[model samples]
Target: MTKLMKAVVVPAVKAAWEVRQRPVPEPGPGEVLVRVHACGICGTDLWMAHGVLSFREFPLLMGHEGVGEVVALGAGVTERKIGDRVGLPMMQKRCGACGFCREEHPDSFVTAGNCAGPTLTGVNVDGALAEYAVAGVGGTVLLPNGISYEDAAPTVCAGYTTWAGIRRADARPGARVAVVGLGGIGHFAIQFARAAGYHVIAVTRPGKHELARELGAADVVTDGAVLKEIGGADVVLHTSSSHAAAIDAMTGLRPWGKLVLMGLSEDEMILPALSLTTHSHQIIGSAHNGLEYLAEALDIVARGQVRPMIELFPLERADEAYRKVADGEVRFKAVITL
Candidate 1:
């Protein structure tokens, strides 16, 4: 009993996406059909479209982040039912039986698409740009007060990235924290740093200094070197993927400071070997987090501590939204509404 629904499809790599009517998917055992409320235009999505990343097949329904309502429930699912507002993040499902899952290594992401899950969704699965999507019950997050589905949508990825950055820092009260690139990840990083009780310094592109300051940077500086001049901090989180920015950020650290790379960077990163070989600095690549951090992110947003900036667009207008994100026309995050 497949119903008809509208979805965005990329028929091939490096191909333009087109809107198509797809059959509304039914939930299998342990699955649920979500009526997408909003889907965010992420950097990874842009990269995938541009061939910076590729896997599986094209002509696939692709969406990784969205806020939706649980319109149908599969067998064995009891906690959620029809009309439950929820979020489906990038990690649709991780293998609970994997060693990584056992060790609770947040980096051990074993998704079904990597397994046998619907690769036709977003990036190999039918994603949120569609009127309806099928997702595992495990990865769906129920939205709480203080977050509209529109606002909560970006947090599915952006918020989690910032949370992972903060966790990597082992941030404590009064620690000096610097966040580079105040875009989606950067904006949330500042708020997370504040919540962690750190002295927040924002580093962004020269064009975003004013925006950075407004977001709670004690001050915003385009020059990362000035970080060392001010004696630096215990943690510097990199949310921008620019290689030059990463290099400059390394030099800004105080001795033994931590640099957590959290953003999407397609560019091959080159760092000064001396920084790692000579100094006792901690440099960690912050990957997307597990359910633990996802819950934490939801909690923060529910409590109104971390708010994701989002713009809404009809799902049909996703290409326009993508162009805006790529062209830097969107000030914060842009979401496609179904």
Candidate 2:
């Protein structure tokens, strides 16, 4: 018998979504069917729905972050059993025969980005907006102790993004780091930097000063105005769509320092190349992270070092959630429960 489950579907661009019934997916070869608990709304979801990003097909089941339990495993899958708690992340799934997959170094992420989310899966493939989802066993993370679905959801994206930027910075112990745009990624950045022994200076508009401090920022400032006061930082991580801010991140870095840009929004990014060249600092843009760094980041969360702040809503309230996110009213991240 075919099982029909509720799914949040985006039927078209610039149109309201419909909650329709989708047949529960069967686990294919090397795949597992999971009963999804929570899936967070990401910035990419917002952009794709509103025509800000136009690379995806419509009528999409758009979500990447999911925490759930395994219900069934497909052929050739014997490692994990039914009812195992795990997290399904949005990552690249490269074919093992590809050059990228074969070159999985410690510095590189997992070899599974080819079929990943954002640009690929969720946007391209059916994602976790439904009550049940199917994910590959290769890129999934089995959860550690005491990690809840709501909490673990954000780590799949926001946490990994922060980890990528921080690691790319190669921040030394006791060094000062600045996190620009204190939203989902920014909140995690402050916590990760503080826990990693860096003095975190969180930069946002004035409206977020108190919230920034509450998230463990050593200092908070209005974007670019008060931000310049803390000159010559060891590293600056940009999680904003602002093109000018991308340039500022580079100039803010100390000589030989690092500027990491994690947010690649639709806005055209224009940077002053001469200034970047003169500083001798490097500006690097990182896309998504892999399992090894994600596992280490999860360890940090398990040890109570880093946490994500989120606003929750049920699956039925997705439109309202979208409004709040589109208006920038969401404090950190927003998630729709199934």
Candidate 3:
């Protein structure tokens, strides 16, 4: 008999979701079947649900940050066993033949002709909101025994994204790093920046000062004025959705500083002419980290170097979790447990 599992499915654009049965997927070659323990809801999922992002199609299963146990393996899968805990990241298997992968370069995260392209899991395919999901074996990371599924789920996406930004900035110890926005990615940026030996300055709205400080920020400022008061930052991790806020964050960067943009904004970001030419400032956008980088991210979390604050909701309450995330009322991140 064919097995089935419950899943949260988006039937149409801006429509109500249905908790229905979906077939238990079998792993293909170079893939593995995972019994999902928890899946974190992301801002991209919210955008996909509401039809904001143009890449999404109707009748989609939305979730990317998944933590589970490998229950079955497909042909040629030797690295994973049936009971190992692993993370189902948004990135899939990488084609080993690509020049980017052949060089073992960290920055060559190719989406096309590799592992399911850049969309990867949850964007255009079946995702981990279900009880069981199939993922390419290459991108999944085995979790340490000390880390729980709930804790590891958010790090797969939120933590990795922020860590990628920090890596792109190439910050050194004692460098001043400013984190703009106090959402999920922002919180992780603050912690990762601090763990990397940089002084973390959190720039957020007025109400988030205490929470920012609690997350290892050396200083908390409400606006750009205070950022100017403390000289300037060597790097700025911009995770806010507002274009104006992102534009304002550039002023905080010192000469030759990097501003890494991790958030998705609909408005066009207009930059001043002299900012880049005179100061040699860089505006880099980072997304979709590769599996090699994700493994490093997991190591940091497994070692207790950083922690992801999350609120749990059962699979049946997935709608409520989506609503909470969309409303921007969530304290940090929200995870759905099976």
lDDT of each: 0.76, 0.76, 0.83
Runs off by more than 4 Å, candidate 3: 54-56, 94-119
Say which prediction, candidate 1 or candidate 3, comes out ahead on TM-score.
3
How far out, in Å, is residue 206 in model 2? 1.3
Q: Model 3 TM-score?
A: 0.92
- Sliding window of 10 residues with minimal summed lDDT for model 1: 112-121
Runs of candidate 1 with Cα error greater than 4 angstroms are 95-121
Model 3 over residues 41-142: C-alpha lDDT tens digits? Answer: 988888888988745568999788999999999999999999999998776655556555565544324453243334367876789999998988875789
Q: Clashing residue pairs in candidate 2, if any?
A: 91-116, 92-112, 92-113, 93-112, 93-113, 93-114, 94-112
Taking every candidate in turn, the Cα RMSD to the unseen true structure, in Å, is 2.7, 2.8, 2.5
Q: For model 2, state the Cα shift of residue 262 in Å.
A: 0.7
- Which one wins by lDDT: 1 or 3? 3
